[model samples]
Target chain A: MIDLKRDGDVFVLRFDAGENRFHPDFIDAVGVALDEVERTEGPGALVTVGTGKFYSNGLDLEWLGANRDRFEEYLRTVNALYARFLSLPVPTVAALNGHAFAGGAMLALAHDFAVMRTDRGYFCLPEVDLGMSFTPGMSALIQARLTAPVAHEAMLTGRRYTAAEAQAAGIVARTAAEDQVLPAALELAASLAPKDGKVVGKIRTDMYAGTLAALRGPVF
Target chain B: MIDLKRDGDVFVLRFDAGENRFHPDFIDAVGVALDEVERTEGPGALVTVGTGKFYSNGLDLEWLGANRDRFEEYLRTVNALYARFLSLPVPTVAALNGHAFAGGAMLALAHDFAVMRTDRGYFCLPEVDLGMSFTPGMSALIQARLTAPVAHEAMLTGRRYTAAEAQAAGIVARTAAEDQVLPAALELAASLAPKDGKVVGKIRTDMYAGTLAALRGPVF
Candidate 1:
């Protein structure tokens, strides 16, 4: 399930994860949050979070592997969700509440900035294990934002990592105490909220465009 | 001219900086190398390098900046090149001969791994400095591969980084004496080759897809 709320100029995007219940489309929920942030909160910044144990665990592999017919739906739904967020005309802060795996990792990357929790939070993407390719859109998104080897290692190994390791790899913006996630994200949102919205939007948009070219270029 | 030669299972894809002049389409030439490698050598790994003191200074700046119309043509051409590399059915290896600036930096990132020279070499994506943003593709490629602040610092500020700093920032795989770049790349390529083409492909592909989802998720 998805939960979107607001405090002043900061819109909060949260998700629910239960025992044996996981879905990929919440990624799209992040898109819905972006819409709400822009339409209701005006052209300002927002924070994305997860309730309870995780930012997300990704494809719900156990269910997906058995119910493979829906894989394309899962992919399209998740892609649309991320597309909405990327297209949002404002800044974003992903407050990773806990471990973000696979699609969860993608959702976190979609934001303008990310603040990860230092508790038990971690990150991983294991899609290659299942024998599919990273969609061109995904490659463009990631290759555009991260470093070469780091990106390569992350993608190739599908290795899991702690928030600390994620930070060292250069993706996580800040590693905060678990209690500090939303507060930190809100603070960041507040700081960015008052900036020149158009300039911020332009920079974000142009930057995204430039890198998309590189990833989608040659052989991907 | 682009040189596509063979050496054992390791094919050599070098930037032919003939008469010290580089076509703006160097990006596509690299794509051709990737295709040749995959077609003749199978779905494994390959290395890309420039023949001179530059992985690439980018656009011959003097030539490209002067020719505005052809510039668009070149841009699209490079996009096709990088896209081809990304979609190549195998992993890639890049050997940065010297500095890889502007578009060159973007190209380096197109590879799955890069061995950049540490001493004289440097890397950057300074398109913004030229009163232009990188095309959408270029920006997205770096975003998906590198971390945000790092990618933006390079893209927005258009700053140049030494090979050492590049390595510290996790840009290049390993920096060596310029003369050693090809050797290091070939050595890595040879070692990377010969693994179960299917298994290694799966490993590398999964390494990229799963790790991306796990570490960052699906957004650019």
Candidate 2:
């Protein structure tokens, strides 16, 4: 389940379901929440967080196994979500309370900034270890969000990075104690909320035009 | 002038021209040196450097001023060169013995890694200040090479970053005294020389597919 709440100028979207995998219904729910965030008027920003030990575990493999025929369509929908976050009109931050893996980690990267809980969990992309290659869109998003060396090592080695390591690698902007992740994200988002949303969106759109194009392209 | 020399497994290409601006002839000279580097067989890598005061000062404005009709074509050529170095078969390193500004800074970014001279010079992107904008390919290259926030700030603010700041911003891998810049770059390149050039090229091509496409596409 996803919960979207207003805290001052910040829209905090919390992922409450266990693991927070990208199920169709879950994706739809998050999309609706995003629609609401976008409709908000004047001086606003977004912060996404997750409850319990998992921020998000990425794709719903169980659902995918049952709906194999929808694989490409499902990935397309997921990629769209990434593009949306990447070019959102308002500033956005991911408050990583726990593990963010593969697609989940990428979802975090799609944001303007991210704050991770330092005490536990990891940010990892395990596709290489799982005998999978990234979609071109996914590759573009990762490469755009991270520096070349960090992106190279992370993608090729499928490394699991702690909060400190992720910050050092430029994956996350900041790290805080378990209880401070959301607060830190909210504080950062609040400060940025005053920027003109249209200008922010335009800059981000221009800045990530290639990434947006890749994400909007075919999965195959 | 461009000088190419073999230093162990590292090919050291020195941009000896003052300011090392990207004049058409300079571009041609650099291309010739790169051709030699590509022809090298067995273990090999590349280290691009410059003599005193300027690693490179970027575009040859005087030349561009005199030949306005060739602007688009010239940019296309520059973008192609970036694509070439980005996907070079062997590892490449830029040894910034002095200033790297605008397109020159971008050229350094196209390398696999970079070493900066700590005691002198600055890494800068001054287009915004000069009322100019990056070409699409150049934007893609910079965005792909830098972390999102760093890219945003650098491109928008036209910030001049010192070697230490550049390193912290992930613009370069290492920094050394002015006298050691080339040596550091050569050492790093030589260590990576044994990696299968084909594999390295393939991985880089795949990793930067979107960037490569943009670079190889229209200059506009």
Q: How do the residues B1-220 of candidate 1 rate in per-residue lDDT, one tens digit apiece?
A: 6787776677777777742234655554655666567766453566778877777666566677578667767666666565555545555678988778876787788677788886676787767777867666666667756667778687788788887888776677777887888999888777666544444465444334433332222221
Docking class of 1: incorrect
Which stretch of 10 consecutive residues in model 2 chain B shows the poorest summed lDDT?
A: B126-135
Q: Which residue pairs in model 2 clash with each other?
A: none
DockQ of 2: 0.16
TM-score of chain A, cand. 2: 0.99
How far residue A191's Cα lies from its native spot in candidate 1, in Å, is 3.7
Candidate 2's TM-score reads 0.61
lDDT of 2: 0.91
Q: How do the residues A132-188 of candidate 2 rate in per-residue lDDT, one tens digit apiece? A: 788889999998888779999999999999999999888998999999999999998
Worst 10 residues of 2 chain A by lDDT: A195-204
Task: Provide the lDDT at A108 for model 2.
Answer: 94
> For candidate 1, lDDT tens digit of each residue in A65-180?
78788776666665655555665677788888787877778778878888888888677765554444566567656655566556667666566778888888877888888999
